[model samples]
Target chain A: MNSAALPGFDDILAAAARIAPHAHATPVLRSRSIDAIAGCSLHFKAEPLQRAGAFKFRGACNAVWSLDAATAARGVVTHSSGNHGGALALAARTRSIPCHVVVPENAVAAKIAAIEAYGATVHRCAPTIAAREAACARVQVETGAELVHPYADPRVIAGQGTATLELLNVAGPLDAVVVPVGGGGLASGTAIAAHALAAECQVWGAEPSGAADTFESLRRGEHVTDFVPDTICDGLRGTLGAPGFALLRAHAVKVLTVDDADTVTAMRLLWQRMKLLVEPSSAIALAMVLGHRQRFAGKRVGVILSGGNVDLDALPW
Target chain B: MNSAALPGFDDILAAAARIAPHAHATPVLRSRSIDAIAGCSLHFKAEPLQRAGAFKFRGACNAVWSLDAATAARGVVTHSSGNHGGALALAARTRSIPCHVVVPENAVAAKIAAIEAYGATVHRCAPTIAAREAACARVQVETGAELVHPYADPRVIAGQGTATLELLNVAGPLDAVVVPVGGGGLASGTAIAAHALAAECQVWGAEPSGAADTFESLRRGEHVTDFVPDTICDGLRGTLGAPGFALLRAHAVKVLTVDDADTVTAMRLLWQRMKLLVEPSSAIALAMVLGHRQRFAGKRVGVILSGGNVDLDALPW
Candidate 1:
């Protein structure tokens, strides 16, 4: 993909402005105990407190609102079993457009209910990425709706970047910005915004060892599509999207993988020390810093707590 | 106890100034999902996100700062097994003075560790009010340190009131303000602040049914002093402090009691919907309001989430 096809800082700025009226500028929380444990000053961007209880709302809102009149009139469709579906449903609601989501048959019941609660039509797929995509494509063809591919879309990438943009603007001069990578929308956007706003700042992406496609992709210098994710971080189970993968490679964003146990430990620590209710996916960013203290020690690190949409009855701990 | 001895709105203003450089002016968090379920506009004053993970820091800071230079030079002493001890310990550290906390032997190890982590000298006593007080008095006499009673001191009362003062000032006029009544310090402070700030606003106190002294005290028109607390809300086990009770009575604060089950449910909902890690004691405030929605229905109610210090292994659920 050409650089022109990828999102830039201007797109991020526009996304920030476009979603301001809808999305929350979630707080930047600090914890002395957490900092002491990590041996670094960490500023946590709490996207768990965002509009749809996740930062996915940023990208979803940007995609839904960026649509031209006729395209928007036909509504939007996507395939997600997590925050993205709920976020897109909520975003489409703002524009009074219909949203169709292709979720897996084995998806968490609570998540499906949440997506439906946000007014999205749910189509159960056969618990495979290929099945989900096929179902989504069928919905798009039948309804003449636009497919808002979660992370791969330029608008969605720009929207995700706004979180890091807000964090850098408020926290000021962070030595590094770290984001949890799943499909890589957030990490790609974070890299673009961090580079554009804070030239000296380095961006790193943390992925689950159970779902280390992004880590493998970066190491092999190409997208790695084969992996059966077995992590506690449900949100970080997807394969890295091509556009996001390309953008991350181009920006030289380093990728690291943390074990599920470490992510759970990080989640508990965040809950205990920071008084934040974040999911394993959100906690992985902090886990990355703690696991590799030599790289982040004594530095000001900005961590994006991606989301907080866990089932309370089935907590990993 | 006389009205003149109680903290006034002016004292709250003074406390705010005294602790401005130390305490966090905690954010007012709102959730449409919570509001929809409760049938009210529930604005949460998130003190769980405050220093020492509770609102106790406000009172502790105010008391520490209000001391004369010579008195402050001698440090401070208190008897508490929970957030108060940790709060006072942190507060004393800010003033560069020693702090001695008399915690009971039966206190949770996590709570004790947290208090000690705040740099306080911990003296363990038998799990009895008399034993705890004796140890506190001993510490004060031996070290020439001032005793800052958790909820009874005028300065502490004024300091705790500042949470509600800031909330009223920022969240605008509320129809009612509800706070968890652990020993009645926060309730007393909240009542005084609400009455002074919004004369028409009703102030309500929530207590665990197992530790329902405050509810019974308000009902009997006297401070009830005997009962072994059996609730999961460890922070509310203390008998209602005399000064706090007198202030609550003077301000005509209504008191309500909630079962441990309801408190746990409220805590889970707050964690799930609001993305906050609050203790069961803090959740009781919202439980009281939700249990009696007829009173708060369609009204703007300010609910104070008092603290967030819980053992992950021993969650009520």
Candidate 2:
């Protein structure tokens, strides 16, 4: 696959079939109180309940499985200090393949423990992109492992699209689908699935205001990745991937930015009202829906809760 | 129905049909990590996802719907300060009937708000059982409403059993089923359903060590409700009802007592590992199983996560 090529809807379908045995067909949950507050019928695609407690599992599982047997036998390597690393590690375990994760030295011990718990080798480096990438490269060479880019890879993008495909298939006809934008894999893939399967269904991306590189890039009609993230959404601080940017732009996906305060409030509401313990990154989707009630009023909106991995001791509220 | 009479398996089946439209057939969730920890195949009946965020909704809905049109029209009244109050209120709203909740003066403000949010009339009284009963009686007399006792009512017991019924129907055959013993509605109902459907499956009750009235009652072969509850499980502080005791004793249900610390540990594990934010009251079931792993080893155990109604600001751990 070309480095900058975006995965198509057909690729998403293939990814869905490939990961059917591994990934969970997470339930779509509804909250009446949240609907009343937002003035819209919201169908929540509960990816928080996915394997590894995030939608990242879909993409990681697909990437791990898409490799040829020879390459798969050599194992897979990724650099992530968040859900994708654990997701990839778990995906590798499903196939009984060796996995290596390049983690930042400053990464939370709990997150590193979680990745290790999934039976992955954790290689820690200094807390910088250069250090992380070099660590990942070293691991690939050392173990003859295949390098699986977390979001930029086409296989991962197609896997991410599977969640939206399932959502559309189960949620009937939705007026719109909103997904949180981090490295843009989920948002772009969601756009592809929603456009191909339900053309009339508008696709929107929710990003944290403090880490709105994707939002800025779309606004400027170019790539923008110089901003420092100050948001509480740890999983959403990455710059938008090149392929993800291309797909999202081509699909004309709308981007909505929400403040961290609003995301925290939405997170609390999800916990208190919907009984869902989602992280700030996942809650940003709900924040977008609630903040833009006028635009979504009386419409059926599907919001993907991206993940539920949170440090319970350090809750935002 | 006699006040001390136990509900039969037939009543549970009828209740299942009666409340099918109102109550959710909650999903049975499984966690590989949790299963590995206990050395048992655990099927967690996710009642925390049930309507009103607890299995209480099942029984409450059944009770409201079981009433005759004229009696239901007069409405239903209950004295509760927790999930049952909110559940009854929501259940009554389903029937568009007037519901009165006699909440104690010291009830959590959030609990009161939850009940009021469901359109139930809140009547505050002193924090004594006598005062709560008096307030319920006043409401019953003033509005000619039917009194819906929290647990003692046969209709409610039958309704609570529907959760286990659905669990048994979907989870195949289980070696045992563990339920938290609160006012005993869930435990007694579970025993009735488990014995009738899977006669070989053992039924066990988990209770807070500080509120082990049910445990003591079973040990002494009589009712025991003199001790005050000191545990953090607010929902399990209630004394076991007469009907619940009679049913539990007749079914030979065994009770297991767990410390509050163990319940908190299990609660955190559920939230962190399984991504399920269950209350300590519900976590007690997992605590019971983990505490007695040898008894359940190599067996399929169904654990009911009773509810997810917790004060986020006041998590034990």
Candidate 3:
């Protein structure tokens, strides 16, 4: 996808229009207690409560809805071990289309159940990225389904940008927006939206210190991969896709890394102080702000709580 | 605590007006997925997000605010192991009054810290119901602090009623309202409000099976106590207070009980399905609705998620 020629804010608005009836305009929450602790006024955009239990629903719904009747009739397929599979499954269910998800056998049982519950066919593969990709390709070849890459697709990015559009509309102006980077779908969308709406507003991506592929990639001015991460943030384990990396480079997003312990502490603090139930992946942005307080001290910060689909019985802490 | 001449709905409305500026009118959430699973439309009045982190704050704020200037100048005292202590402490801090909490030594470290963080002094006693009361009495005698009983006080009940008033206003008429029962402040207030607004609406009290003293008392037509509860729902261990029992008896409220395992399951399900971080005590109401599905099938049921103050690391599951 070309950054200069890619769809802009108008595309985001159109995506919002297309998916408005299917998605929830999740509320933006302000926390005085959190503000006092952070020494900053913090606005939390609660995308955890979005349909299919994450912000991925925004992009998935848009991607599925943007398909013409003929293409939608051909069905859709995606490879994911995170929120995107469940989101796309639910979105395809809404459109009465057959959805196939290629998931690793080691995927979280609850998430896999959620995907199946949304009426999608699940194709299990070995617990390797290569095996998952091969399974998805096989499914596409066998069924002639249109592939929707979670973050690499253009429509998905536009859909994800609508979250920031709504956030800015509700929270007014902020000095900075902090987003957790997994494959950078949410971060790229937020950066693009922030640039379009408030150019001066800084966009920062928070990644797990263990999975600092994006951080290293941005610093080295090239895509990084082949390094294994041992982070508790299950959702932020993927390397950035090419489109996401290009968008991040074009936007010059600042990248910060937080360790597993900081993510756990941040998750606990959110539960204790903010009364929010967020996955460790969502805690990455919060961990960045709290663990590296000097960079954000006394500044108005907007943090996207990306998702809350955590297994309470098996919390990482 | 006269049951024969209980204050009218107008008095409750007055309490709402007095506390509206200080209290949060927490958002009401509707879950289509929960509706599908339960075979009923469910409306959740999220008081867990209330000021000071529980519906208890509504009453505590009202109780502290309703005090005469002379009485407030003297100071205030209450005995609680849960949300009420922190709420009253914060409420008293607002008025620059000395607030003393008589807490059991075994009270969770987090709750104790919250009470102290709000600038209230805590007097620790042995971990028993009798010891807690004795400590409160001793403090009142020594400091002349006005005793603010956690649930038996009429002012406290009136303040808690505001939550139901706001719920009804936002969600409109519902066929039934389900609230958790401990000392019954929230349940009693909810019953009175539902009775006043829509006489046809049924109000039910959800109690843990291990702590079903309220169920026994209602059946026997008198208050019952002395039963030791072994439930994981620590917040629902209290025997029903005098005013709370009288109001519940007079209102003809139904009592439903759920086991501890059900409560934990409900807690996890709420986190997974509803994206709400609630304690085991709060999950009891959802447990009742889910465990006793036949009673709620095809009806509009409103549930009060009482609070979200939980030790996530040691969640009772």
Candidate 4:
């Protein structure tokens, strides 16, 4: 749990073994149209088709299963009402343990319904980050549930890394592996995985111009905590976690930022060309490549499509 | 191309071999949430991920390849402004032959752009069916190009059947194979493939209630062609072809119709739950299963998501 000694590929391997039976080995998709547009051969690791419609399930599964039977019996709690909460809820269901989600009062009904559908109790809190954290703390005190901070947890990062591990194993050596950065769980894990598996492969992080904290942090040589996020990518509005930042800093991962407009265009292109319903955050990875075609031209690049939980009524286009 | 001399299992086998070198073996997707909602174990053969974003490529590839070298050297032509025209154009390109497409003047610019993007020369004609046919005939005469009908041709039907062949071959065994019916190209081909590969498997056709000619014709034991199609499923607006009808009748393929509203709802649900961007026609197949749960409940059902060509600017929902 210490940033000084982060989890390595060994922890990722252990997470893969722990979550193998519960998690899906999602398909790797390729599109000639996309290849032509981006001027690169793209291997899309489709985590949108994962158990909870996101890669968060792998980490949630590992974190839930890592607990001993006695500790897991008390259940787990998280301050997320997004993909992580739903994933955690489903992971808890698999272990037959109680799960509590602290959701902001303004969270979408459909998302809350999805989390509740996984049989997790929902606790409503004010929309502020502090309020959500306080509510999560209250749940932890009341139910004696273990808190699984969405990205800061080392087990969650290790679980997320397995996606890149599987991608490298299946797609073989690649020019680079691109991932969308939010709290940096997936990006840090992927950097570690690519380093451990394919040393020759470069690791890059994509961020929305609106929520470019990760890019600015890597640029300024330290984490920048203060920022007002403004991005349509709901799953990627959180600040980068300390543990995830340490890993990214240690690995010297290059972070690229794309405008929200380009992210929307990329998302539309993905839906049209690849027939994949990926979120705006996931599209940023491809946007980064398309915007930087000179760098990735004629190379086989692996991109992780993080999630697919979208509100149909409130479409961006 | 003749109704009396319809294609059978042998033709499908030949088609599989012919298209193997050109077409993609698209992945079959599974979703736990969809299964829970539909009360069936569904194996979705995702043809949207196929080349040209539809199963049309399989038949187009088969038709182009079925022609001898001398005949293919001349070229290929078709009257279509949808997935079929694009598929034939790409197929012709693969064989290094000129492709001519006769499109109605009122066809969407996006559809025409996609067809032209594949290097097909577009010949504009009036929106009337007779004008389109006359234009297509002119192209055939002038360019000495073979006329490949969208779904009526025997070679095309056999080509379409290969999608089901691959699905059955990969998904192992299924209780039934469901497909969307327009001109019955995919439906009849799937019926034939199911008969050949899995005799115990029942084959059903899904159609839009607004365009229920296939259902009416099968119910009345004849081909019916005097009705206007009125559905959001643009891919399924055409009448059932004579040869396709004959094959369906011979195989006794049952046709079920779902309302356009239901098809749209199903399409939205697929995007939300399965992370798939499927057209309304493709969604009808799953709508049928969900609408008639008694028939598909507790069974392993195979449904072909026929295409992913959607107008992002004008979504039905």
Q: Pick the candidate with the highest TM-score.
A: 2
Better of 2 and 3 by TM-score: 2
lDDT tens digits, residues A147-187, model 1? 98888888999999999989988899999999999998999
Better of 1 and 2 by lDDT: 2
DockQ score for model 4: 0.88
Considering only N, C-alpha and C atoms within 3 Å, which residue pairs clash in candidate 4?
none
lDDT of candidate 2 at residue B21, scale 0 to 100:
86
Q: A98-129 in candidate 3: lDDT tens per residue?
A: 99999999888888988999999999999998
Q: Could you tell me the TM-score of chain A in candidate 2? A: 0.98
Question: What is the Å distance of residue A230 in model 4 from its true position?
Answer: 0.4
After superposition, the stretches of candidate 2 with alpha carbons farther than 4 Å from their true spots are B2-4
Docking class of 3: medium
Best-fitting candidate, scored by DockQ? 4
Q: Tens digit of lDDT per residue, candidate 1, span B1-317?
A: 12238778888888899999999989999889999999999989999889998999999999999988998999999998888999999999999999999999988898999888889999999988889988988898899999988888888989999999889888999999999887888988898889987799999888888989888988988778888788999888878888888888888888888999998889988998999999998999999988999999899999999999878998766
Order by DockQ, highest first: 4, 1, 3, 2
lDDT of 2 by residue, B144-222 (tens): 9999999989999999999999999999999999999988999989999999998999999999999999999999988
**In model 1, what is the error at residue B104, expressed in angstroms?**
1.1
- Least well predicted 10-residue stretch by lDDT in candidate 4 chain A: A1-10
Candidate 2 vs candidate 4: which has greater TM-score? Answer: 2
Worst 10 residues of 2 chain A by lDDT: A1-10
Error of 4 at A164 (Å): 1.0
Q: List candidate 4 segments past 4 Å from native.
A: A1-5, B1-4
